[model samples]
Target: MFSIFNIHRMSVTKQLSFSFLVVIFIGSLLLSLPIAHCHNAPATTYLDHLFTAVSMVCVTGLSVFPVAEVYNGFGQVISMFLMQIGGLGLVTLISISYFVLNRKMSLRDQNLLQSAITYDSANNLKSYLFTIYRVTLIIESICALLLMIDFIPRYGLSHGIFNSLFLAISAFCNAGFDNLGGSSLQHFQTNTLVNLVIAFLIISGGLGFMVWRDLYHAARHFFRSKPRRLRAFAKQLNNHTLLVLETTAVLLILGTALSWLLEASNPKTIGQLSLAKQGLVSFFQTVTMRTAGFSTINYAQAENSTNLVYIIQMMIGGSPGGTAGGMKVTVVAVLFLLLKSEVRGQTQVTYRFRTVPRKIIRQTLVVLIFFFSVLLTAYLLLLEFEPHLSPFALFFEATSALATVGVSMDITTKLSTVGRIIIMVLMFIGRVGPITVIMALLQNRRREVTYAKTDIILG
Candidate 1:
């Protein structure tokens, strides 16, 4: 007979996947309770509750029902809790619990933690886990305080504080669930303070914990040493940090500029707003499209060009080891570099004078192929189930779900039961990652025989 402790014997990928599924199941049960619903709200089905639970636990905010209307305060809190667990990750939470209980982690436990968080080694696991929690707390606390400045006066003390905290967690987690009715942050489109605060939170969260740690150390070193030269400070940063920062900055600027250009003449989106306000909306959309689901404009009414732009942005998503989801910025960066190398007739992919390993290139290609395969399969299934929706609309929704971006173009509520289920599975897979799923299912077996390789003709 196997015991719960035997879970430690499972492979890291399986352990992590199983942990996420267990959490989602537990969340579903809790949300299905009668108290989770509003008193006057119509009777809700179990499947809907389960769907909402999965969405929250996956931190993919595609809800079958409007969260604000259907869930009461208790339910909303439950949703927030689920988001926290999902954002921090199940393995991280379990490690935190062990720390709180003063339980010494075994070698197997450390291996599990390392694999779950994709940490390179067990040597710095403790410090890394501590940093993750500490940074999350500090960032979320500051964001909540900043948000309270705007929310308190508007929604009153209790509700405002609750909303502030909820939004803070949701924003930092990239969960994108809001109780401010169904319009999202449309009312605050032009509010500089609110938009900027949320945008910063989202970007910080999406940058990944490793980047945050590097930046923090770099800042500390600069401040402590009082470096007289800028070069000294620049030397403190690593290549990974530089790459992530540069890629993120470029994506934000390009996404914002393209969105503005695409929607400038459209009456439904940024056209009606003043030039300054339009710029603000465009900037917000760019930030949110990176896997944070909050939106300032009606995405459903967005021009086809704008939708196409968002599809690309959403698919690229945030950095690895971050709260946000999608194929990841690093993966895309590797792919771009590989293409550039090939175009230049080079055999090795190099960035910033550093050669990217062949293993990394192969891994990126595998992830891309798996991502597209899943995306195509889901799109085909959705087309069969929802023949009424436009192809772009369905593709957008499918991409949003697979990216765990939670930004639907008004198609979520209209999805059929099967469609919703498909989206749920996609959200789970997206959050867990296609690679993780593949690893979980297939143990890494070593090949017993070596064979000669044959080359196939290429374009």
Candidate 2:
């Protein structure tokens, strides 16, 4: 049996795991309420309710049905709330709660916060937590105002306001839920302004809070400094920020080009559109694939090659500390750099005049091992459960769920209850990523015993 004290004494990892579970369960119950659905909406099973709750709380947006068709406005509010909390993270919310109560965080709480955030130190904790919330509210509010320009006439005053707010939160959080809900923003593909604003929100959220904090601090310094050169602002940013920015820029460009090249001639895709629309849609394809999950094109009808690229992009998702999930941009960047160095016969993994830490390499390995292990396990289980579906589709579904990308083949509604459960687990793991980050953040002590190095045969 579990006691309150025992629960309180649990480590940061366990607390996070338990916290997400609690939120999911509570959200499931709330969404299952009678008022949550329309009077004429088809009756849904608790599993479906649970699945939807997990989808929103995990910020995955892989619903088993059309959300707007089934759920009422009240349900949408509940879902938006879930997305907001999940995007901001449970730890950050808890910190906010403490702040509201005017409670001081214990040393244990500080350590937990540090481990939870993977921050270098937990000093000035209030400012950090406030900054995250402040930034989120400001961005989401601005995007909402911008979106209302288009949504107002289309949806009427009240509906437009709500829709704009919901869409804005969803986009910035990379949750991908849309009340418009025919083909997710496909109707707005030609609305370049709306698309661009959404793209900005997606990119901003996907960059992660670390970059946001760094940029915020940099801007502050630039304002205070005697000379305000842009380079000085950039100089204040650490290599990690630069690495994330560089990797993100490269992926977006390459992904956009690859999507355009592959799908430009596919009649089922953007091939019929004008060059400008095609380019815009292709750019959206790559941008949304960066864990935002909005689709301007029918992924079901997309070329196999295009889907392959999208899958890779989903797996190599947004940066750390943000709402986005996946193996993460930094992980891919470090591994690729490590490989490049190894091929060049360099002993040290050096990048931009800095050496990659040995600890980071080990942590990266742990993340990959944990990530791939779960991904493969889920893929195999999905294959067993969904034998009628193609292996490739299952792989795509598994990867999407594991990365919390939410883009799926037209098969989500066809999944069995057990399959949905599997997807829920994947979403839970992907968003929280305790298994991926826990071992890396755990405190390890130096071993007194020394052993001789052993050689192993390799390919």
Candidate 3:
């Protein structure tokens, strides 16, 4: 018989995956209860409940039913709870429980926690976990206060506070689930306060905890030291932090520029807004497309080019260790560096005068290939199940689901039952990560044999 300790013996990948699965199951059960739905809302099927549960637990905001119309306050609270746990991660919650109980974490527990957060080092794991939770709560609280500044007067104290809290958590977790009527921040598209607040929250959350730590340390050193030492502290930023910030900036600029150019003339999109609002919306899209699902514009009415741009952006999601999903910015950076090295006929992949290990390159390639494979499989199955929808819509939905980017083309509710199931699977795989899922399924057996290598012809 399996004991409690047996769980600790399981592989980190399996434990992580199982933890999410269990959460999804429990969330589905909670959501399926009648109290979770509105009294006047149409009767929801079990599958629909399961779908929403998976989406929430995966922090992918896709929904088959309108969140505001179908769910009452109770249901919304349940959804938020699921998103909270999912966003913070189960391993994180477990670690916190251990800390709260004053139980020392075993090395295995520390390793699993490190794996969940994608932190390279296991040293000082307890401190890092505390820091992560503290940072999350602080940021969410600040964002909630900022949002309440606008929401309190408009929504009243009770509703406004709830909205602020919901949006704050959603934005910080990169969950993208909003309680705002079905329009999802569309009404606030031109609202500067709403736009900037959500944008800031999304960016901060998507930056990942490691970057937060790096910035925190840098700030402390800079402030504590003499003016002459500021430059030295600035130079202390690690390559990962620098790479994430730089790539994020480039992607945001690129996404914004492309969105503006492609949709500037369309009356349904950015074209209908003032120049300043247009810029805001464009910038918001750039920020949100990196796996945050909030959207000010109707993506269904977007130009095909714009949709394609978002597809690419969603696929190359936020940085590693972030709440956001997709292949990750770091993988893209590695790929770019790899391409550069190959074109220059260099044998080693070098960045900032440092050589990237071959193992890292291989792992990046594997992750990229795995993501595409899963995406392609899900896309094809969705096409088969959702034949009535346009190919572009189906493709976009698949990509969004897999990337855990909840942006959709208004076809989510219209999808067939089987199509929704496919999306749920994709969302699950996406949240757990392609590599983790693969590792969980495939046994990592080591071979003692040393084989000679031979060169193969390349294209």
Candidate 4:
């Protein structure tokens, strides 16, 4: 007999894709129980539960119904578990189980784990995997406690503590699901503590684990040396980590500035906000576009220009091998570097005086093409199904789904059933990744034939 969860028998990519499906299935079943519902919850369908399961398991945060209205404490706890599991990934959890059971990881296990998260190290995997969990736990816990400082005062003891924990996990996981009745931190827009803490979690989660490890080493190197220079410390890091950091900084700064300026005069959003509040709100909005999905303002009320800026930010999400999704900052950076090198008539594509490999260049192009193609297809299909909604709204929703960014234009509830399924599929694909899905679907065939190549055309 064959099964999707037969991990040892399937390819790594297949295992990666199928594991999420299994989790989603199990989550849906758990959520369907009568106990998962609130005492006076609205009538909830299986479809809604399944959709919520997919949203939670994928860490996508696009739900058909408001979670708070439907789910009781038990159900909300289940949702949090799914988000954490999805965020850290199955490979990491398997390794954790091994750690607990004192089982040694086989070479095959290492390879599969490496391929799943794109982690490069084979020897240091145990440390790496553990580090990921430790970091997630510490960050989420601390942030959750800090958030309680505010939430406890407003919502009171039990609900306050739960809300803080949920928001902390959601923000760090980039899951973006808020149970605070849809407004999603809009009331906290003026609260500096809430805004900054959430933004910090988003940025920390967006930077890949590899980048964090590199920074950890850099920190050690700095303190150990007698004469430590900041520039020297930065130069010591690999080009990939440096590139991700640089790109993240550039995107955040640019996105915040552009959004703040564009929506400054728009009465619906930032116009009523003070200048300082506008800046703070703009920064949080920009951070959320890195696939975090926690909104401080009404996205639907924003000017078209501001929304355009958001679409771009969503398309180019956060760094790779982290909680966030999209093509990744490193991929976009490499593409830009390749373009610059080609335009300069240079033989080698370089960034920060380091040459990028041909294999990496090819992978970047593939990712860019695959994500763009899928997003466009979803957009066109949604437009067909949702003729009543604004074209821009549909586009925003589609991009958000494709990027695994939870930012919506206040149109999620208005989506038709077909449209909802389409969004769910996009979220799954986006979370598993375009490359991984393609690799999983492809047969394991070896092609060794070589033929003479000829030029077909010239522009």
Task: Give TM per candidate.
Answer: 0.93, 0.95, 0.93, 0.93
Worst 10 residues of 2 by lDDT: 434-443
The TM-score leader among the candidates is: 2
Give the Cα lDDT of each candidate.
Answer: 0.84, 0.84, 0.85, 0.84
* Poorly placed runs, candidate 1 (over 4 Å): 1-5, 90-123, 435-453
| lDDT against true structure, model 1 | 0.84
The global Cα lDDT (0 to 1) of model 4 is: 0.84
Candidate 3 Cα deviation (angstroms), residue 200: 1.2
Model 1: per-residue Cα lDDT over 1-459, one tens digit each: 977677766656666777788888888888888888898887778888888877887777888767878888998898988998888774465565467657666776566456545565446776788878889999999999999999999999999899999999999998888889888898898899999999998998899887887778788888888535667777788877788898999999999999999998998887888999889999999999998889899888988889899999999999877798888898899999989999999989998899998767767788888889999999999999999887889999999989988888898878889998999989998888654744442344446687899999988
Please give, for residues 91-209, the per-residue lDDT of candidate 2 as tens digits.
Answer: 45567446775755677667656555645554777777777888999999998999999999999999999999999999998898898875788889779979999999998988987
Tell how far residue 92 is off in model 2, in angstroms. Answer: 3.0
Q: Give the lowest summed-lDDT range of ten residues in model 1.
A: 437-446
Identify the runs in model 4 with alpha carbons over 4 angstroms from their true place. Answer: 93-109, 435-453, 456-459
Q: After TM-score superposition, what is the CA distance of residue 173 in candidate 1 from its true location, in Å?
A: 0.4
> What TM-score does prediction 4 earn?
0.93
Collision count of model 4:
0
